[model samples]
Target: MSPAPPTPAYRRLSVEERRAQLLDAALSLFAHRAPEEVSLDDVAEAAGVSRPLVYRYFPGGKQQLYEAALRSAAEELRHCFDEPHEGPLLPRLARALDRYLAFVDGHGAGFTALLRGGSVAETSRTTAIVDGVRRAAAEHILSHLRATDPGPRLRMTVRMWITAVEAASLIWLDEGKQPPAGELRDWLVEQFTAVMGVTAARDEQTAALVRRVLASEDG
Candidate 1:
């Protein structure tokens, strides 16, 4: 029988490769299930490794693994808005939303776990990680507006849009991603323009930004 095809030799992974393997497995679980619903055994089994090996890598247990997964997700979320400044502002925003919403759709339950408080695995560090993503998103929006030193009103307007985006994302997940992602993205872009218009009525900086955006669109 050809000696069972001479069983292939097992190759060992480097430390970084092994860690990434475990993180990918854990993140996959966390992406579809709540942090509390996931266990190290699930991760170990997914990674084709033993529980001791998981514990060996993450001595702080599931909490540590959860935090690591959250950080990795946060890093990706922060970069979702890092688009080139080559297009009209609204189109740029739309492109950024496309990436952000794709992440939201892909992560679903994990996104909920990260944003919604009350998980057993919640910690100050995890909260900070989530908050960092929000702050980074706000900053990116401000940069897109070309506002280096945004006034209080302009800053609040931008931040409020960021908050609204987050709330809408959560709602989208709850509604089973209804309204379609492309529709939602376009709607969000409109909301930003509308909110900026409302703020521009009272804030000179926002007013100027609106004019520049309009001129760009016209151009």
Candidate 2:
């Protein structure tokens, strides 16, 4: 018979660590549920802490906590398009889309509420946070296109693609994440490629970008 093993000592979390832990717990709940559907008790249970402790950290109660979680999700979505300038544009975009789609899959419930709107928790502040993420994501994608001064047509095309990706992601979540994430990501990349091809026909700047992207891939 084996001897009983010692139970690990439980160390107290510092304020920052405790706050981060609570936020993580809240995010996980929010990931699968609407903000109105989640209670502070749920967050406390998820974090393995007491309910009053959750209130202690978030004095303004559930509203404050929901806003904090919203900001965190927004920040993550904003960075989803960030990729190293090390490869061909198409491949790099595919990698970014993989990260983006993974976030969508993990945060399906919260994402649907965020983008689809009409939630009780939706406020101007939350709306601004979501809009900021969209702008930041567009900026990141534009950077990869090497477009420092993209013309109107090129800019509009990129923005349209961002909107399309967001809409497609919402539909994917609605359909129970069908067709596989990889398939969705590859299809998005192809859509971007095709759109760029069409845009290049009428826009010199986009045409130059297409040429540069193709040249990099051939290298």
- TM-scores of the models, in the order given: 0.94, 0.92
> What digit string (tens of lDDT, one per residue) describes model 2 on residues 1-219?
997664321348888988888888999998888889999999988888888999999999998999998898888876777788887778988988999999999888988888888888889998999889888877887888879987889989999999999999999998989889999999998999899999999999999999999899898
> What are the per-residue Cα lDDT tens digits for candidate 1 across 127-180?
999888888988888888899999999989888998899999999999999899
Model 1 residue runs over 4 Å out of place are: 1-11
Best by TM-score: 1
- CA RMSD per model (angstroms): 2.2, 2.9
Candidate 2 regions off by >4 Å? 1-11
**Model 2, residue 174: what's the lDDT?**
88
Clashing pairs in 2: none
Q: Candidate 2 lDDT (Cα, whole model)?
A: 0.88
